[model samples]
Target chain A: MAEHTLVITPHKTPRSTNITKYFSLLLLTVLLIVVLFPLVVITLNSFKTEEEYFRNGPLSMPSTLSLDNVRAVWDRLDYTTKLKNSFMISLATALAGVTLSLLNAFALGIGRIKGRAFFLVFFVMAITLPHEMLAYPLYYMFKEVGLYDSRWSIVVIFAVLHSAFGTYLLASVFTAFPVELLEAAVIDGCNKLQLLVRIVIPINWPSLSVLFVFFFIWTWNEFFLPLIFLISNANQTVPLAVAMFQGQRGAAATFQSTAALLGTLPCLIFFIIFQRTLAKGIIAGSIK
Target chain B: MSYKRTRGYIGFLIPGVLAFLIIVIVPFAANIGISFTKWRGVGTPEWIGIDNYERAFDDTTFWASFQNNLQLVVAMTVIPTVLGLLLAVFLYDNITHHFGPRVASFFRAGFYIPQIMPMVVAAIVWRWIYQPDWGILNWMLNSVGLDQFSHNWLGQQDTALRAIMGMMIWFQLGYPLVIFMSALQRVDPQLYEAASIDGATWMQKVTRITVPLIRPEIYVVILTTAIHAMKTFAPVYSMTKGGPGKATVVASYFSYKNFFERPNVGYGATIATLLTGVIILLSVVFISVQTRQERLESQ
Candidate 1:
């Protein structure tokens, strides 16, 4: 049989197709609205003046869009400092996580070294076990070492913890790496370090970028560890600051929504920017 | 020599191993040791030998929290996995075919937006919406003449768990959807095409081809999301603080309360140890099941 003869386009009757199309579209649209509803409400309330929010309630149309709540929440929460702290922590975590993962993967994935299975299992546990199991002990250790309430502790913790996933991912990626390239480089007298710097790192840059992006956002969004460790206002990251602020009594509705909007905006912007990388990373990270 | 080259590569692992030991391994061991003791944060722990564990077993509050976590598994794991499979199939099979990939991806991105936000932010947004007097839910209820339905969602014991669970379903839906959609890409379009040529309805195609083909991704989604549900803390902490009389007290929050808030280090460590054991057990079981399935398929 000719292959072309076998390649027939599946036909659906137009009537059924039209009905299913409209039905699926309707279901998707309604679900999307429900999913986006909270975000939309928060964004709208953030723009509404306090007086209007109070007088008209949260659902009422804002008579005029205002930046007053945003400004108020920003200054009140010292959001700039929190954003800076979050950036520093996230950046450091991403850097440390990627470096550690790359090194580990190089040894395990390409080196085919001794105890690879043992190390792999160890990292898997690191990813699987809850941070709560590590929390009190870490809290005590950090306090004893004078690292408690310091941003460095969080950086160290997330870097190590989050790198489990990173190592797992990068190791698999590196395992499938072209052996011909390594052999060719070796024939050219490239040492391990030289091969890594010149061949491996440059070639695997996209995978490394995925790890970097995930570690950054995961660290940014971490709340429990930060809440436990970063006790001081000055050292707190963005999410911790906003969450801690929520615990305060008599917080106004408009201010609450404003804080939520501002707290959520940075990650939203990051997602929009790194979304393609994120989607790729999610599939890469989860499917294997 | 090649042996020397391999030895040098071993040097690459030193930093990662050292950091893992210091940061995770040591703390985890300490936490385990602490579980078998009696201490109040400051004093040296007295070796009480399973007393904390015994107490935890008897603790109604711990049991309540554990039960609540089971409910969350349904929210975070079961609901998301089911809904994600349907939505993934719909997007990949129907939307991509009918509306175009761009439209399908647009909806996918919308669903995923909440997953990218900080859990605290999502909790805060939901909390505000669930606020009693002036919140949107209440406002909408009153507007729709369903004033009787309005209540302080996060404040009432009856509504708080369900409210948080609802938020979690929304937060978790995108994870499986994205994973399954990508998994679907790996499926042979010809299978669907064959089924389509045979006049297999959409639901029939989903149940027959889409699901079995993406079984591996489905397992992954369930395992990871179940683990996520097991360790859920931030939403509970932020939204209700496991409040309205221990109604929403998840195991993580309970452990946290013992660890930090109430300062019961020993009992807290006990709770943490148990929680860790359960999570590890779940992962092991799921992984083994996946492996067995793969082996069977290969055979």
Candidate 2:
């Protein structure tokens, strides 16, 4: 490697160049603040009493860190129940979706399938279609089949609807694996199932973790389908609960703020735990 | 290589293909079929043969929403792609040390927080900040002597769509930035070394080397962003509800209103079909251009 050069040398820099870099950084900082400030405001406000909230500006820090707002929203929204429902639905979707997707990806990507390209393209096309277009049809279909209003129905819909895209992502990971290793395993009298469990699963833990975190976050954040399909507040996901809070109009701010604070917690926790894997998954998912 | 091996491959594809057919393909085809009918989703359907499409074409709300979507597509495609490419280049160039990429990646993840956050949460938070009377945004503006610029951002037609688009750009910048960074890393370091050896400057190295190698990704970004812009619903639904006299409406939101809110399933299906057709056309054009470029390079 060449020696690293740091120049404090008096070089003539163009005024425009200096202005552009400074401008870009300034703009970036402003954008970051804009994005993060509201979230911070919500969290801060959630700790303030209702009186404190009304008296002070939304941006102002709470005078005392009290959890009155949090307590009130939690009681009103039944936040723990909502959170449990959300977690159950999300976990079910992620687990089932990831497993099915891994199987599909393995078969299509590494099993020397004849029509792999056709299936891959079909999934891509499926992904491109507007999701809302399918909602009415799916609603009718599920109602006709008596699957409506069931948690399993929502879980199945979320999982299967997202399965193809997840498979498409996982297929890229499968494609990068060494084919010779699989062939050698097969030669050693390993069945297809055994080979997958022993060889592919062991080697692809990183990809699997990435997919898990991605699907978890996605299912946790999903709103539209859950809002339409899950009518009862008893079965409402966190996002749905939050959205329903908005339906009350003027009184919605405090409730909505509380909901926002509650809804973002799980995702923030997940991000903190699996930040690197989450980044990898996002980059991988986007490219394909 | 044998017939048995072929059977194995067929067996492997069966479950996935069947699931996809039932969940995705059937619903898609059903949506298309519904577009040609006069059903309110409860009654038996009557064949209306392009009436819904005609109504969609004539509906001023639909057109306005389509226009908003077009604006979004244009803004998102250009602004995010350009800004993301610039950020990718900056990170790649400035952060050449061991810890540079890691720090940049951390920032990239930070930027993605909006993307990962539920749209409901994002919209609620933004709505709070954009609240005209009691908003933090107005407070900050007044403090900075720019109070005149403050408005009910999501409640005003003039600034609602733009404000929402700004939110989208902030939320979406991370995905493309990360993709571009990966594509940038794939660029052979030797080329940059050779460019420097030939007395080419940093700008020249980027324009000639980095940009060309990442054209495919750029195309993908444009295609995805455009399609996503057209189909945006969650933010609109959560933030403005197509409000300030439907100024923030998009095609997908219109479809949603027809389907769920109004129960005009046929009309919603019509809008959806049109949206899908547009998306398919864009994708075809993009794929064809990419293929043509590849063929030219081969020759």
Candidate 3:
């Protein structure tokens, strides 16, 4: 069968293809520069002294690279406290959100569930409503319940807000699982919980991991909710800290660059570490 | 496969369903309810019927902001979608090459930095770059003997929204590009080869083969970008605060200020409800038209 049929076509000349390829490469290079130049300027200027920042152009290198600006930004923002709070909020949200979504997906995907379509529509509606539309009501409700300023308020809100999309993605993955495997497990008298824990989780680890990383990054970078909910300076996230820093440095030219750098560093490190998973997650979400 | 398990499903779904109801559904319904009443957070909301919506229609500031948002949607959606498709084609055609695809993917990720980074941080960096007197852009322009073109970009009413729209295009082009690249790779190579053997040029191949194959992805990208453009608040809030006489105030930012900052909860909800209605209507129209087209093609 492998050798049953054969077809051949003449290959195009390497010279023509090479010229077009080089032209595409040149265009791509120009785009890369335009996209990355702002970030490059920020990172470079973040290291320069105050006088050097003002005297030299933004794209120029400093005569002497120094850590003074970084240190100053660290102190000004009380970096340690903000970092700890952000970490706690982000980790809690990701863990709780992913777990709940997985459970929801399993129930809808594998279980002999009634009203699955209804639940799916509910989740879709949740995703469609803008976050701003829910802000005021949530604010008032949290205030009434006395959870407004607590870290748990933001964490729970973030987790709940994220669960809708997470469930949608995870459920789609679960639907692709083989039905025979689940039936075989059930024939052996394995319960739903045991089946989900023992079989489904292991089979879908890649998808789950992708969702986890995406949710972590999104929750960590979420700004508006934390800004509205977390009233105290002590509980502010990195984005809030950066916004406040920009507000304070509105008058000062030098501190703004350093502040932006300080704020972007953590997320940049996370992105570098999880670049592949992030790419997979982004593709998965967008393709559907 | 038997429908024997009744209690198990209920137990599994109860927690997630309850959470969604309390957090998402309740608030969403309450938002609609609140739009019909006047409230200032300090007193009881009095029923005002359609007064807020009526005022929103006549409000010059609201119209200006809505128009700005429509402009943003137009600018960001069309340009980036086209650019992304081109980039995706370039990458997909070079997929077998070792270094080229990697370099292209790296550029894709590089373009995504502005999107993933908090808008506040990106705005701060860009504000400095757009500074007229000591900024890099003006400096470069002057050096290239285009000094007449240099102006305070964010300070001018006429240019502020366009400047921000340009920033939005920069930030948003990556996601669509990545998605299109993946979709392009999934396109059957036989189609392109067949087209080429039929004496089709590159432009003809793209129009006759690539665009038709990627219509679904294009629809998704356009819908997502339009919705995103409608909900844009952080950039304007951080960078301009809808300044220069409300020049850059998109509807979302206007609603946000009215709701939280200015304590016009009724008015804010009215604007938000209207925006939501428009979005839903547009989505319905798009989906129905696509569904009809798909049905016709299938038949």
Name the top lDDT candidate: 1
Across residues A202-284, which tens digit of lDDT does each residue of candidate 3 receive?
99989888888887888888777787899898888888888888423432555777777777888889888998898788778
lDDT agreement of model 2 with the native: 0.78
Compare the candidates by TM-score and give the number of the best one.
Answer: 1
> By TM-score, highest first, what's the ranking?
1, 3, 2
In candidate 1, residue B235 scores what lDDT? Answer: 95
Candidate 1 fnat reads 0.86
Off by over 4 Å in 1: A1-12, A247-251, B1-5, B196-199
Error of 3 at B155 (Å): 1.3
Q: What is the lDDT of residue B150 in candidate 3?
A: 95
Stretches off by above 4 angstroms in model 3 are: A1-16, A247-251, B1-7, B94-100
Q: Please rank every candidate by lDDT, starting with the best.
A: 1, 3, 2
Answer with 2 or 3, whichever has the higher TM-score.
3
Error of 1 at B260 (Å): 1.2
**Per-prediction backbone clash count:** 0, 0, 0
Tens digits of lDDT, candidate 2, B1-299? 21123335456567767877777788889999999998888979889999998998889998999899988886678788888887777767654432356666666666667776787677776777787876677877987899888888888889999888877776677767878988887888788879889999878887898888998888888888888887887888888889889798888888888887898899999998898898899889988998899788779
Would you list the clashing residue pairs of candidate 2?
A: none
Consecutive 10-residue window with the lowest summed lDDT within model 1 chain B: B1-10
lDDT of 2 by residue, A53-131 (tens): 5677566787887766677788778888899999999999999888878888878777757877888888788778777
